[model samples]
Target: MIEFECIQCGTSLRVENRHAGRTAWCRRCKRPVLVPVNATPIADQPDEFPTPVPPAQPVARPYFEPSQPPALEEPQETAMPAPVKRGPIQAMDTDPRNAALLAEIERRGRVIAQLTAEVEALRQAAESRAREGDLLEAELAAARKMALSGVQDTGRERAMIEELNAIISTQRELLVEKDEKIYKLDAALRRATRYSAETDGNTELPDVPRTLEDQTEAGGYEEGAEGGDARANVELDEARRLAQHRSLEIRSLRNALDDMAAKFDRVTVELRNAVLKLTETQQDNERLVSELASARDRLREKEFEGERFSTEPAQAPAESMEPALLEESLSSPVQVEVRPEPVWATAPVPRPEPVRAYSPPVTTPASDMPAQPATDIQHDQRVLVDALLRFLGRR
Candidate 1:
């Protein structure tokens, strides 16, 4: 037997002298160690075997388990143990077969040691990934919470918008109703003016025609002219009174329209502000949604990598690691309940129509009948109508 200690782990190992000058793995550290040749003379050997085979490969040795537990700390690369030298090989019959066998054993030992190290590295990587997965799960939970809150906020905003829309529709209806009433009032006023003109025409029309046909002399003409002057004065007074009443009504209607317009403008401004707020909330909601999706995708990728790295039975099961929670969060839909808003067109406020004064036509029996009074009456009527038209236009 050849006795030697491992250079890396300092473990004592005993191998058959047939394995001399061969490399083997350390049972404790799993690193390759060179077995030194026996220094004792061949006469001291107890048993000898006949070696006749030239190309037969050496049999692989069975692996031995360590008596003690593996060390908790990993070996550092920068701090390697010094080599332990053993005595050189003793003089023997020079043979090519022994050299070839030793070389083969050494090569096999190196390959096994490299594979073992690779597996250890993979195991360490899997453990580190498991810890990262736990942190990702916590973050996913937080993101889910935030998304829930955003959904709730969006719901509230939609409700408020619905209420505003309802109010706007009602206001629109009220405006339409008011417009119809104003139009009806305008039509009624026009009918009343027409009827009054017709009545005045009926009253004054017969007198002028009768006077023109029956009067035959200058004395009859003078008496007719005097009577015409009195009638003209009465008509002027009636026209003035009617004008004042119509002016008051028009003024009141104009004030009402002004107030309604002011209210409508205020409502429009409020609607604009509400729309802007809704837009901002929607943008924020979209941003949050994108963030959630990205996070979900990242988590999925991490899960895939984790699955690939961890194949050991000793590692925790994927199901026990809260995959359901992640799936639930990712799969759950955020619903935004929406109710259709009524679109109501705003009606323009009705403006009061311009008032026109009506006058009956008058005729004189003779050319000698004084024409100055008739001309003055027509001029006064024209002035009053013009003033009323200006007032209504200004309003």
Candidate 2:
């Protein structure tokens, strides 16, 4: 440390050796001063004045004022008062009160610096929390999107299930039909075997008929008995094959339905978990928001306290004048302008009548009358009777 005195203000200054021969501004007077290459020790300097120097000591006392002391005393005293009056403008090294004031100012400065740091930390925390909230919100939106997709998937699965159920029902009906056909074929086969046993020495079975009607026709009776047996056997084989194929299809469809149900259940569970996470995130965001609000309130309170402390000395004179200003303001009467309500505001408004729906005018059909007046009367009576009967029947 290089200790030096500022020539401009005689303020004590300390700087590092690295700044030797460099020009720097004085902290006290804000004037540029050159830093010495070598450190200046306080002990080496002459004690030209007291360590706790008072600013307003006399420059010099008149040496020839021994005689006529009372006459010169008045002039000397008058001149000394000017420097005394300017005492507060100089350094405050002597007064205990000024020292206390300096200490308080320094303490307040430290407090302000600490508060600033705390506010910065709080701001950073709030910013981080806000970012976290945004991320959570985005996550929540993604969850909602996923949930919507899951719901759509579930609906699709339900529709698929319904289609499968319809298919299964149709298959059941087809199976019942096949069962009836098989029963009829077995009965026909039984009858054929009985006939064949009775006619064992007769002609062998012929080519299969396409339909029962073909075999039952009178012209086809010669070939009927043998052809009917062959046709029943062919139809029974076809029915059994179709039933087996249908059963395989139904089994595959059931497996597909079970797989879809499992997927639906898994999706449902995922959606539920997402909803729970969304709720928890919302709660955390709300808590952070409340904490941020409280922090803002505390920061505002701290700012207000700082402002009050800073303004206390300035407000002293204003507070002293408050009573006078209040009394003066009270002595005067304030004028206010009053406006009357508009005629529209006080008057009742007329309500419009409700409009009715338009109806088309009804026209009576022209009467069909004979040129003879007696015939016209009979025709009108008949028309009236028919109209009355129709209306009564409708009722």
Candidate 3:
């Protein structure tokens, strides 16, 4: 017999032997399915009398029974099998396999213990390494940050340097302008000096020609006739006067030129010195600025070093002993004297005397006293007495 089921509905199907190798439809679902030759038919007959179904109950059972009072059946004794002859018993210590096994177990245990210790050590080492790595990472981050800060600071410093350089360049340009102005002024003064010198030299040349011209003009007769010689002398005098006036004007002009040249030279020298001093001052200022920056850098380095020193951990107690040892090795003892002395050893100082103010004595007026006759007094005596009286009165 063969079993057949509907593919779609999973329903059992039965077919006659003659209907083998034929297609059929499910009776329940009406699904087409193939019928096999060996299909078994499910029985559908009902029992004539039905048996009562038992009610569900809990099964009560015990794993083990209690001891029995006695056995009801006689126990039968079967023949025991004869013991087989065997080799002499071997001592556990003499068993190489067991010993080897135990040794191997011990070795394995030791290996396991070592491995466990190593694992624990590795764990601690890993933890330490991790901590170290974390610290290093933090340090690296800090260093990176510091480096970036340094780079920024460097950029700022570079900018500051550029600004300073620009300022210096501007100052230099100003100095160059000042120098140019000074040079121009000096050249001007030099030209003025040469001009004044030439003028002075020409002035000193002589009043000889002017004096001769005046003498000749004075000796010559004038055109208007009066007393001829007298008129001529008068006209000549006037001409000599005119010639003197002209000479005086020339002298004045020469003096004026000399004075102007002196003034120019003086001003030029002063300006030149001033320019030199200004340049010196500027150089000094730059030197001072450099010194100030160096001092600040040193101060910052010292502060950083101090911070590092303060942040470092203290030395161990054993390490601290070296200072004591050094102290002992280098120690020296010296006797100190104990002296007793009077607390008031020095003499008392003398006090200064008070100053006294002078008071002037009062004098009665001369009018209140008797006056001597003026007739009795000689002229010389009167002058002397008046002088003496005036001196005394003033005093």
Candidate 4:
């Protein structure tokens, strides 16, 4: 028997020598291969110990029809080969074709492993890129929202500025109107003060003259204290200017009224001094009227003396006339002359002085006038003159 290895699979086999150098299929690998002719058969060796090999059993081939294996023929055992010249020839290396097949298998295995590792790395890269894309989308959405909010805030600020401008303009107009009102009030107050002062000094209102000049100076202090001190300082300056203007006007009016009253008192004093001169002129006129009445009384006495002379001659009876004629008298008109003195032309005017009257004539018809009657007449003349003087003074 000869023993050999299957070139494709390395499985051991025992075969007859006739099968050497033949092409056959390996039972385990199922691939066709050539057997080497230079191989040493195991049965050809001489051994110090001989071991028997089991017989090979027949195997069925699924690819062919059933057939019987060839029977082995008996042969004499062979002797061992002579000693080798260089040592026993080393066993030949495996078949070149078989070695080539084994190398190709190893190369294929390495290629499969490398391809698997590359596929795993590519899968991890894809997952990382997807996560990054999701994060970028969220950031873009936030930026858009912020831009919209900024635009809304800008529009609101514009509207607020416009409202403030309108309010400021209205305040300016109100200030102008207020200034006009203040000017009108000041002018009216000044006119009233001046007119009152020009009128009769006693006829002015008691409090109004004082208040118009001073109220602005004295009032508003309470309001200033209630408000803040900073604002009060500004208003106080304006109040001071107004008070000064009013005070000056009031002072001028008061001075004018005092001068007019003083001049009127002086004129009244001069008129009172003229009264003594007027009393003397009235006494001289009364004396002239009393002398005229006495002359009329003397003319009656002269007429009675003439009548007695004529009646005594007629009683002698030489120049006899009718006795009835003695009781009658011739009718004749008598002339009396009166001399008049103008009292006003000759009267002397002098400053006020003392006066005294010594005697006064009486015009009443009596045989003799009593001193009591003349005294009464003089007293009555003095009373009449005083009444007339008083009436003139009043006028």
Which candidate tops TM-score?
Answer: 2
Question: Over 4 Å off in model 4, which ranges?
Answer: 1-123, 187-395
Better of 3 and 4 by TM-score: 3
lDDT of each: 0.49, 0.50, 0.45, 0.42
For every model in order, what is the number of clashing pairs? 0, 0, 4, 0
So what's the TM-score on candidate 2? 0.35
Q: Please write out the lDDT profile of model 3 over residues 10-65, one tens digit for every residue.
A: 89777665667898889999777888766674434434445689999999987887
Which of candidates 1 and 4 reaches a greater lDDT? 1
TM-score order of candidates, top first:
2, 1, 3, 4
Q: How do the residues 1-395 of candidate 1 rate in per-residue lDDT, one tens digit apiece?
A: 66778889889887777888889889999988888775332422558755687898999999998799777998677967898674332111143223433343344344334333434433343343344345445544555565566566656666665665666666567667656655665565566566556545654432343463454554576677667656655655555565566567656656765665666566566656656655554554455445444544553564454344333222112232244443443353422121221111011111112113332222222222222322222333344345334433432
Clashing pairs in 2: none
The TM-scores of all predictions, comma-separated, are 0.28, 0.35, 0.27, 0.23
lDDT tens per residue, model 2, 1-395:
57888999999897776788999789999989999887663433355544786699668866764565465544443343343444432344453334433444454455444334434433443344345345445644655565566567656656765665676566567657656765665666566556555666666655666787865663467666568767756765665676566667656666765665676566567656655655654554454445445444554554454454334331111232245443543353432112332332222211111111112222221133112223221232243334334333432
Higher-lDDT candidate of 1 and 3: 1
- Point out the worst 10-residue segment of candidate 4 by lDDT: 349-358
- For model 3, the stretches where C-alpha displacement exceeds 4 angstroms are 1-103, 204-395
In candidate 3, position 373 carries an lDDT of 33
| lDDT of prediction 1 | 0.49
Compose the digit string of candidate 4's lDDT tens values, residues 281-328. 334333433432332243234323323322322112212333333222
Q: Decide which is better by TM-score, 1 or 4.
A: 1
